[model samples]
Target chain A: MTTAAITVEGLRKRYGDVQAVDGVSLTVERGEFYGILGPNGAGKTTTLEITEGLRRPDEGTVRLLGESPFPRNPELLRRMGVQLQASAFFERLTAREQIRTFASLYGVPAERADAMLETVGLTEKAGTRENKLSGGQAQRLSIACALVHDPELVFLDEPTTGLDPQARRNLWDLLRAINDEGRTVVLTTHYMDEAETLCDRVAVMDHGRVLRVGAPSELVGELGAASLEDVFLQLTGREYRQ
Target chain B: MSAEAFTSLSKAMALGLLRDRTAAFFMLVFPLMFLVLFGALFKNDATARAEIVQVGRVEVFDSLPRDAREGLEEVLEIRRSDDRDEALEEVRAGDVDAVVWQEGDEVRLRYSAADRVRAGNARALVDSVVQQANIAATGQPPAYGLTTRQVEDESLKAIQFLTPGLLGWAVAMGAVFGSAFTLVNWRKKRILRRLWLAPVSAGTVIAARVGVSVALALVQTAVFLGVASVPYYGLELSGDWWLAVPLVVCGTLAFMSIGLVVGAWAKTEEAANGAAQVVILPMAFLSGAFFPLDMAPAWIQTVSGVFPLTYLNEAMQDVLSRGQSWGAALPVMGGLLLFAAVLTAVAARLFRWDDA
Candidate 1:
């Protein structure tokens, strides 16, 4: 059988008084575009971090490409790309230099790093320092760095949260192209439209639990709701925010 | 693959440090400024007067001519002591430059070798006093003469000693501040988490950071030495001066470990900076980076022994100024290594990848 890109089961995590991710489970098949949709404080980022092996789960098993992600399996790490919610770069480095540095970490060629920058439409801004880049431009550079090594699976957290409508649409196109290249793409966001537009399936999370899981349209149809927001409202017996 | 990661990370960090104007200034120009300022201030000043203590009544000194006695007193601050043992202890402890006494016709002068220049001066002044007394007694060359002995070597100057002490402080400040600020800023900006996502281990990242710090420390040493060695400053390097390279490396590691502890414990850039300053500033003063510890109180000298910078400064001075051999620096290097090992353990225990 072909292994799923990611498989997480019975995930549980707690931070002091808050249960950040309680009994969460999900799977993403190879080459699938997946989303974990939630509002603020929904534990989407925490769950993603655990799955990416950046954090250890209080209780759970996460297998990426048929290997455990925790304990830092280098084989899995080599095949996965992750972009954190916060954009980070080496200080005083220009865009080209930044991506090239990341590429070198994975033993990728500088030419490939430059190509990835171009693919993200940041070629013209390659010479600009990271601090000087616009929000959209910086985000694009971050994604370019993540994909420079061509990992088989990619994880992005809140990639479009602060962009303008124009920048957001442009990023959506770039993400779609990445998925179309047959890489398994997993993302977390609060935007209902973004989930409906990009993900083949999405897990709706609220207050540290997965409330429901399906394609956006399938979820809406199952509940006989007008939209994914209404579906969330009906599932939680409350109005959906964000 | 791991090696590649380490090399790339080190290069990137080095570039980042060089490009940050403030960091570059602290690492190079700040120390050089201290060297130039202090060198200029002491350039033309007369040598300090020697302080001597008389163990007992020396009949020869008592019989010196009135003019000769007054002249010798001008160059020597001599105090009389009844207990010969206590006077000898003071000389050994550097409380006094020399201790003088008389046995029959023999005038004896004993001086501490710790401050060779002062000891040499004290011996010369006391010998002149004895010669004048002999002439007054017989009006011809006397049968007995002044006997002088040195506790150690006699080849040091104030500037020669000052160079190593100041250089040690400069290297220490650069390593501590550089590592602490880099680690805290990286965590605040989420760069630590980003590196965590990569395939390399955290050890590799830290090793790369340490590599860059040591490289910068060596650069600081070269700059300080180059500036001080200028003919105008007249810094004379000893044969074993190259031993300072290993000593500098060990000292840098020890100080960098302190920075790591501060960085790992602080959650904000301000906290890290404050914590580093709290640790480094006092060490600079207590380690005798600005003044000789021999002149400090005994209690302060004992307290200074606890700081690794003390060992480093002492060893650097021994090799760079006092012309001591490698044997003098071995024990200090071992102490610094032990210090580095202990602090590294503490830092590892406190390390965090992110604020969360």
Candidate 2:
């Protein structure tokens, strides 16, 4: 079997006057926890969406699990999972109903949906409507839904952007455990500590282009910085939150 | 996979609509309220009585035979007046429908032509009364007396026409408002965006929504027909009542396609609401739902002919009031089907999952 989870070459996208994803290229290996770190408007989410087959690239090639992501190939989409930024669910549906509905869409057994909710620590609140879920709980529901079908590759875009510290840490642990089970995980965020603590490899991006890519410790060591935050600032010459 | 997706989505949408209080009211309660309110407001006006002033020769008016006076009384309410000019003033001021006077051997009528429909009814009644008197004067068997009877299957009341028109209005409202608002709200909430990421195709999503819309349309039709046919309204229906099933389906589908077009064009729920009003308001007025087409101007009737609701109302009236067969309503049904197909194609062309 092929070991690479995703591959991209010269991927490009434009929105009128703005070149949102300009010639972006990267590769993610199977079982690798990859993080794309960037500031706001760095096109991190755009790049991830294109690679996940949620969007079409204006130019260049993207392959997910050795198959092209263009033209919305159903076989490719069926084997991949995506968690979007600020994901929403049906307002009046209970969490279990929402999850089971999506599971059936993927032809997964109903029992799998319950197990997935348990894995996401939402078993106790399975009957809560989506509109009633707290911000953190909603994010966890999104994670549970993404992992319900147990695909080979997963993409999460800014999964912890609005989460509290404890909730963020809990999610980091869940993602780490999933990665240890040998499924490829790719996520995008702006948090330096998140990338350092959870990612096996990191790519620092700005202005629609990737500036650097390596193991977090190795990048810090090469730059002679005290931490990945210092290394990121040194490389981009801007604060991590900018 | 498409079938499963379609079924799941349809179930979810129907459940969601039921849970939504605002949507439930708009879909279920509002249409019936309109039916009862408007039906009650205009029910008695169908056979409007004409008011007449007998200005001169009260003895001449009183001299008419009792049967002739009774026949004219059905159409006219006569008020006596000794002064001729005062009765004419009443007619001019629109206080009375018309004024009648007897001068020697001839009787004359002075009426305000502005109220032409009522004035015409008064004139016909007065003419009949004169003919009756002439027949009595001859004192022989009449040569040409007309005979009339009610057709068992046909309904001639204005409410008969209004019921079908109201039912058409309800179906149109359900289809257009339901589809437009739901699509825009879901798109704004990123539901469509999320669904696009799933293995389900766009065509499945659309099919699911259209299916839900059609279901809602049918339910609205059934509820309205059932309520209107009760003892209160006594909807005069005949022929194959089942023909209403296909009529509602086609008519509601066409309006739903219009809603889809609005959904594709509107970027926000508020915009969708505005667009729906713009489309539905004119259609409701022009479809002859509020009044008969014969009562409206020629240009308005011609313009209303282009609206699908017009055909729907026509088909409904044909099936319910005229007791016509399904084959008789083919032209209107064809128009609805063609409208639905064409608009659905346009909506598909215009539809987008994301802002980009």
Instruction: Tell me the spans in candidate 2 whose CA falls farther than 4 Å from its real position.
Output: A239-242, B47-134, B148-154
Best by TM-score: 2
lDDT of 1 by residue, B1-356 (tens): 48878888898888888888987887778888989999878764444678988877798777666887787777788899988899999999999999998887788889889999999999988887676665766777676776885543543445676789889999899888888988898998899988878877878888999898898889888988888888877788988999999999999999999998999999987899899888888899999899877888998989898889998999999899877877999999999999989998999899998999
Model 1 pairs whose backbones collide: none
Residue-wise C-alpha lDDT for candidate 1, range A1-242, written one tens digit per residue: 99999999999999999999999999899999999987778899899999999899999899999999878777777799988788889998989989998998888888999999999999999899889999999999999988999999999998998999999999999999999999999999867888889999999898889999999999999999999878766765565444
Q: Rate the local accuracy (lDDT) of all candidates.
A: 0.88, 0.84
Evaluate fnat for each of the predicted models and list the values in order.
Answer: 0.77, 0.55
**Segments of candidate 1 deviating more than 4 angstroms:** A236-242, B46-155
- DockQ for all candidate structures vs. native: 0.61, 0.61
TM-score of chain B of 1: 0.73
CAPRI-style class, candidate 2? medium
lDDT of 2 by residue, A1-242 (tens): 77488899999999899999999999999999999987788889889888877788999899888899778788887888888786658768889988988887788877999999999999999989899888889999998888898988888888887889999999999999888888899988778999999999999988899999999999998889999999878777754544
